[model samples]
Target chain A: MTTPIRENTASESPRAELELATRDALGALRHVAACLARRSHELLGLSCLPGPAGQGRLLVAVADDGRLERLLAELRALPEVCGAQLSRAAGAALVPAAPVAA
Target chain B: MTRTTGARLIADSLVRHGIKAVAGIPGGANLPLFDAISQTPTRIVLARHEQGAGFIAQGMARVTGQAQVCLATSGPGVMNLLTAIADAKADSVPLVCLAGQVPRALMGTDAFQEVDVYGLTIPIAKHNVLARRAADLPRIMEEAFAIAVSGRPGPVVVDVPRDVQTEEFDFTSWPAPRLGSGPAESPGTPGPADLAFAASLLARCERPVLYCGGGARGAGAEIAVLAELLDAPVVTTLMGLGLLPPGHPRLAGMIGMHGAPAANHLLTRCDMLVAVGARFDDRATGDAKRFCPGASVIHIDIDPSEHGKNRAAHVPLAGDAVRTLGALIPLVPARARPAWTAIRASLGLAHPYALPGLDDPKSPYGVLAAAAEILGPEAVVATDVGQNQMRAAQAWPCHAPGKFLTSGGLGTMGFGLPAAIGAALADPSQPVACVTGDGGLLMNVQELATLAELGLPVKILLMDNGVLGLVRQQQALFVGGRYTASTFAARPDFVALAASFGIAAIDLEPCRDARAALAAVLAAPGPALARIPVDPDAHVYPMVPPGAANHEMILEKRHDHAHS
Candidate 1:
């Protein structure tokens, strides 16, 4: 009798699948810069850090401060980002500060 | 064929021949070919300087063993490539240079940027061509590549006009050109009569020596066999550094101005000198009339002009090194003479001219010795000019053929890193180690990006002495230590610079940890840098002053004061 070939089940192979998914998700999210450039305003600061499951951190700062809330609302509507949060931080350092209750 | 410009055809032909990269400096006359290249599949790399372009092409050719092309716009641009092109000729590297010429329509008009490139390069190049028409481009390029790489490889120049490059042609393809066969037949073995005479002379001689040079490089195994057969010590010229293993039992260090004391001592004492494929250059044999005062010389080389050019030879055998050695190896009998062996052993025991403070517990010699031990004999070592080159030549023990590569003849300052890149590209399996000084490394620091982009695993050892070591030493010994422009300050952080180029770099200084640093760098799987800071005042000793007699070599400075 021939032995059956071992097959990877979805539950057992989630890590590799998650890696592929995360890369695609982050790649799409990064392309948002080009999209925003078509709308208005020049990009002030843009940073990207790799994360898990085709997910990655992207931070974009604009010259105008009020634009952050509107940008967050647009990002939340996108399918790639799992969640969106916005807060004001010191502009010089570009560091994330404690979230101001929204 | 329909009417077309020579430049377009040449560029098209080169592209057809699988040329991917062309390094050059653009100018008026050669702009046509540049236009064609810009439109063709070939990518043109603009060099900051024409000389740099020539060396870059040389590096590329040395790695590929194929003819790499360089272009220069006319006059000074073409002249700039002369040194590197001649270097390629001497080192047997293959390259083709396209020099822009004044328009053929205005021939002999002394057009702007016009120079007689062919006449200027006649003595330096393997071949040269001045395209008479647009139709000549395809055939000329084919012949250029053929001549550049055939037999003893060298550079070939093709001068084309601005009009020729822009002219369009209907020719679909370049016809292949035929190349001539190998060098004309050279006398292989010494005549029976000459062999008998040489044998008789050797039998009567008390001390006989074998001096080898660059011509003997490809015949290492044969040279070793001949050395064993004759039971004589072998010494080489500077260009013949890696021809034979430096540590061979029968091998003596290099012979010449900067040659070892033991080798020169043996040369002075020998009764018979057998020169093989060596020209006995003035640097090798100072005052040829006085060199080997006691010896009768037997010279063997393929070039007949060199037979008696430098020194008188009793037996001049004109042949390739392999064939000449083949003829001589059999005539000499292998007899165990304990007396001769004892003399050789005695010469071996005579300590090498000591570097005054190299024996210090912490010194560059220790670092070199450790490196030699770790890298072993098979490691390919390239050195930049100055004290580091001299020190590496004296201290590093090369055990195999082609293991030591340096810019010996040209003594190029920024040669180490790029040449190491070439050596690494040539043989990926072997480890390439470059020993460069801080001053020399900074000369071509831009090459760090090339190394990183190519992902070559070349290990660089920087000797940071905060001064141009050789110049400083010369000023100290000859000039009154005025220092002049030799002082270097505000050096860049090499580690950070290397990091910016995506290369790993470690400073082997502050930690005073050369061993660990070297080991770590050597063990790394990619290109890395290890900077070792030496005292700025450190000088290379045992220097024979320029134009001074060899016997008057200053082994050490007379006082603590620096010579200016």
Candidate 2:
């Protein structure tokens, strides 16, 4: 896995956050983490909470490099994932937070 | 309803799915599965090495576009199969691999032949499971096939304990096979608005190019229609070679590192690049920042994960290529740009593909071209990695998808012979050629016995350069010509070696008429090996160094400034 070096455009922010709903399977989370690592996105924070009927509510904060929308679209496309939407977080939201080590 | 052992259930599942053959080596742990397989008519190709068995399965899967099977035992057996599994994942070939494991009770204990097969295979396989109970066999088999053949097809591992294989179980009926999780076969049709935007983009473009990858295999007809409509040239990634006929007028040729100079230059000049199914891999997009610098990309791919993974698409249409292109065809109008076509033609003529000693049958490039010519356009060619593989890629005229099979993403050496065997098995009538180098062939030389035993009509076109050609070439160009262990201190006499395996052999270098003799040998009824001697100094040209842009190519000495 390689981290893509970010080249900032005028309209883009340096970092962004996303929340995903996925099947409560380790494989699904592993796949997501690996993909983010491959894309060079830093996972600022992660929270895996139980959702309806074994579904997992995964909150992830990633260092955005202008391709957040594209990344969100790709996350939603995952078979194990049902929904992916953007979110905002302050530095205080970093609970057990740090880049998720792949 | 029938009461049967887990092994029987597995064999029955394969039979139910219409699997005609399997490849594997029977070991202590997997013997029950082999025994059950024997009760059926499924031909089991016994390979000497487990890795060879996995590749043989890959060969069949690549050719048939179906999930094929390979079996191995626990521990070392599964470990040996890892490379092929990784290779399958990299190339998107569908494979369902079964490995026998230790008894359920013995797992996690340091019992003989016990290892964490599930943990090791997780990263490499699309999905993997361990069967703790015999009753789960039918469902596991069904899901395995489904997952293996689904979106972005890849290998799936099913690890069954030795005890599970022997345990008897009752089932009401064998579960019908199912398609794995993915978008609907008929994806949400591209909206009219999307098509309109694409049409408008096409309408305004002066120099538009259609770039494709492996995902565009079955969309050739649609691609041809779009190419005609837009008057644009088609450039394919290595895996996308046959998406257009070899000599199609609109084809600008393959693009990437080691790609044609004309095609790379065309990419640099294009205003709009409609990348259908191409992920813009580093190999294809050298220095991604500079690749197709000014071109606006419209990426179409079934896997949404690929949409902006590498290169962002202005219009990211997520649908099947055939359907997506089918919908867009009606909106676009046909127009021919004479100036653009004339420029492309001039570029091609300026940088010709004709290399030194290519007309000599004994040379590496010459041998590949001659073999391809003799075999005709329909022949399936499998190539091992490095120079031999690239030469085959450059010379072979692939008329259809699946005809030219090689490990593109993984670039696995020792892939040719076994894959050729699998190809031959998949299509018994079509002639198959395994183009391999000495360094690669020796990696799994043990498979020669398997090939001899089967006597399938797979011709081994062995190019004996006596060195790891590509690495040696790089060493010469970049490492001050200090050849380390690239050269073989004592190369095997391939002719005598072939005879030792009970197969016919021919030495092309010693022949009076090498081309004719080579053709004669290829035309023969059974398996044969032809040793074509080549200079170790031969290099594949028009190469873009690791981090250079596509247009920043190091051309052949004779053609350095030819395109200008």
Candidate 3:
């Protein structure tokens, strides 16, 4: 089986999380989803929660393909997003000594 | 406090923003918005198709350097406009698309003309918004215009539900009308440190090239000055054409797949590639790994995502091109590079871009040259896709930035006719030229009726090859000479077609003096069409193969197939 590119926690496959600080703008969640959907196979999981004073937080779990820097830049470019951060490692790293797929 | 309907507020907002005219078609959900616009002084140019409407608005926006508006209703209207919106975003044209949605309750109930416009436009548009409440109309309308012309200019979509359009709300004083949110307010405004880093890099390199794109359109003078100061040659992308004048001493010409051989070869030898607002697109840089292989890049663009997306840069100065170039110019010392000049001259002589039969008025290049001479340097030309577009790009004497309009990023066919109409409508003083081919003209032939109705001074030059010339050429070269599905079995009588659309027609095939006939048609005050029969076997010269490097070009006439 193929190893995970970026897995911060214990998981069966490749996964990385991004925590987005956003404000409650119209269709703000859809903007994030749209950005992820444009890339081939990026979105694995996503969740949004409302915070104080119209502020909100979005947790996105993705299959990091070493393009997360550009992906984060795209996300942060949105007007609705106040900030975007990769809660996982800085860059995608290969899982250590995993079994090869036959 | 006064009260006004959401539609009236949107219309008033348009008027307040100084929008003189809008282009669109009326539909079920957008009737109220259209009616509100009718009540105001903003004139509506009705188009046959919503796609035509979008392109018309795009033409105006491109010419005026402002955010022009286009309207479309739900479902099919929105779907039709998606191409233009995507085109605007790709080329960074400032446009505001106001699309109507079904009433709030009927949105997800599978109503007659309802689709998820918000979801559909999200990926294509630079910014997307949905008006769920009437009270949000003022803020939404204001932000739409601001966002469109802000930073790197691009299209913005605002999806208005029918109920939201008709719902009345208390009106506070309007927000200040805005053209942009300020170039410095956006992300990637370079600091002093970044400018210093970029300047030092440029000052050190002996063979420097300033590669520009559409984002640097507003800073042509600065680019010219920067090139002179650094003793560098300036190379532009397709979108960045016409930024420098025709015979500017530093202009190395356009770069990419179909670019000039001198410009393409120059990239391989440059010691430094200072990309000004250029994105290093695949078309501009073939085989990215091999592009500018010997050079260290200093990329300056407003978008941070483009910094390391394609080719890695040694110095990434993320900011507005005008400000960054201005800041960097003063720091670099002026010097003469005779060695680099000699190298550039030799490369140009070795691989000159040859347009044979240019002396004849009937050929593609000759027709474009004759038309350009009669129309003058002030005229704006819009080209359709494929061979016609490439021909116009290579031959059209583009005098300024916005004068040369083409669907560069999307390469969409059927963009020429309506865009020429829009350009004429935007500025009546300058003549507009629409250079198109048989296949592209047929794609949007319906707009000919619209052109007749408006009676604008648009000259449509038809290069009739009876087939898709570019596709046929590629099929001949790469696909082993099988010209399948590229040829048109029965071509329409274009001269008669123009007459049927209530426009003047001229065919250069039998004309004794084709140049005089063309000059007469282009000089006429109203709409006209000229059909020039082109040889189907004619191929655009010096094409770089799909996966090959810029230097590896397939020359013209090398693979000629003698078959009908």
Candidate 4:
């Protein structure tokens, strides 16, 4: 029996809060990887790659037709990515939040 | 006087002057000439395009070492011939371009197919004249040929009006002048005073260098004598690539934008630079101010205008390269400096701007080296522009002067095959080989039929990389790896194309035994083609990008490991 957490403000809705939390989690993952590689000899003892690697990849969850093609084109145009690709997987459930004026 | 059409007189004059073939495309302006061609003993070859006709004539002239004639109608036809004519002018090939003009009455009336042929060709041609009357045809034709062949051979134009070709006229032969009859005298030996002055400079300078140009071509023996007397290193321009043997200790490679590093370094470091018959083109001198800053320049050439045009000279000797060098040989006092010799030897040891991926036995450099070794000093070599040109300039060992001919000044892409055709014509006794890249050869591939028909013993070595290798190299280095339209996915099978032209063809892939096949093709009496397949992803090293200094060359591009 978990108590339902209340939303802080109408502007800061649950959906917006969840999106910001996901972005922070992705950034933290990359930051921690870089720190560990720098201090590998003292810590995990893993060797670092020779050249500079790019930032973490963006995962856009979209279901619209032709959306993947457009996103792939945009990503291909980027200088960081030498190449690009598309993939499909099982959809994840979205937790419902308190409704706001729509 | 017996009446004859202007066209008939012109055709008869060309025949009388020993011209057996005429190349041109039939058009309204020159219909009468075409009609006359059909009835005359002279064979008229209808070229697909005006430029093609010019090249054909160039080929004929090159083989014959005589003036080859090409015809073109007014306006666009004449314009299309500009490039070939410019090439002829630069390479000193003898050619005659007879361009038809609108009738004199409607000359400036903005008539259809009307353009000022004389005015347009003035800059490119050695000489040009507008025939005002039908009677002028015979005289103009004779003068055109004489002008084309005499004094630094180049193209001459005789613009005949459309109506003049139809008009009837009495004809007579123009009086032929003696060889040395003009105000422009044949070059004499350098005067005693000038020779003594040059000797003084040579005597004082410890690290003197002799830089020869194409003008010293026919005087190879004289150059050898001069080099021996001075104990000076000899470096050549692109046009003078084969002036000195590469094996000679005194011989430094070519000097310029794509020049050898040792040559450029020596040029900058030398105490005295004796420039013989070489114009200091901007490409050779990176920045005129910074070029040969430490050297005291001594310039000699037949053309006086070339003397202070690009770089300043401390001593200017205006005369032929051979005569000047010969005269100076007697005056020069032998001065040997162990220090200078050691410097030159050390510079020689310094490895050239590294050319990666060319170390493989099947590389273009290997093929060039093998060919040079097989042919030795006897075989004449011609090259087309781009990577092949640079590679040949760098790797091929030309043992004698005038053995290597290329479009140096213009860097024309379609030059090699036709030039080889011309070179073959110039000396039918010798075997001529044309080394060209895939992109350069395709520019004028139609000449394959010309070679077949001529039955000339010219071998074409095609390096097929599928892409415009030089342009791609540029894109990769400067354009941040964005491959543009330079890449080609599909290319015609050159071997099959050569076979269709009745030429014996051999296609050699990488790691294949190309030596025997190349030898067989070279040994063949008639025309042949040897197509060598190169890596599509391969790039020529020691490349200096446009606007970049020669010292800042990129030996190789770094690629991502994952992509490889």
Winning candidate number (TM-score):
3
Q: State the local distance difference test value for candidate 2.
A: 0.83
Q: Write the per-residue lDDT of candidate 3 for residues B454-531, one digit (tens) a residue.
A: 899999999999999999988878888898999999999999999999999999989999999999999988999999
How many collisions per candidate? Answer: 16, 1, 0, 2
- In candidate 4, list every pair of residues with a backbone clash: B63-B425, B63-B426
Kindly provide the TM-score of model 1 when superposed on the true structure, using C-alpha atoms: 0.72
Q: Sorted on lDDT, highest at the top, how do the candidates line up?
A: 3, 2, 1, 4
Q: Candidate 4: deviation at residue B481, Å?
A: 3.1
Between candidates 2 and 3, the one scoring higher on DockQ is: 2
Q: Candidate 2: which docking quality band?
A: incorrect
The lDDT for every candidate, in the order shown, is 0.69, 0.83, 0.85, 0.68
By summed lDDT, the worst window of 10 consecutive residues in model 1 chain B runs over B178-187
What lDDT tens digits, residue by residue, belong to model 1 across residues B348-392?
587357654443313666667677777777787878888888888
Q: How well is candidate 2 docked (DockQ)?
A: 0.18
Number of the top lDDT candidate: 3
| Clash-forming residue pairs, model 2 | A3-A40
Kindly list the per-residue Cα lDDT of model 1 for residues A1-102, writing each as its tens digit.
111211222222111100011122443344345335544644666656565454555555555422333344333423234444543433343453332221
Candidate 4 off by > 4 Å: A1-102, B1-22, B31-46, B59-66, B110-112, B149-151, B176-195, B352-361, B374-376, B426-430, B544-564
For model 4, the chain A TM-score is 0.30
Per-residue lDDT tens digits for candidate 4, residues B1-564, read 558888888887788878777788778889898888778788776665677678768767755668988889988888877788888877667898988888889999989888877666655666667888888777677767876776456788888888999999766455552222221123456567877877888788878788877666666677667666667788888777777677766688787777787787777668888888787766666655556667877788765545565666667776767667777877877767778878887876773564443344357877777776766678888888888888888877887765776777777888788778756755667778889989988887888887788788889989889888777766666677666898778798998999999999888674256776677788889899888777755666555445544444445544331112
Q: Please give the distance, in angstroms, between residue B25's alpha carbon in candidate 3 and its true position after superposition.
A: 0.5
Native contacts, share recovered per candidate: 0.00, 0.11, 0.23, 0.00
DockQ of each: 0.00, 0.18, 0.17, 0.00
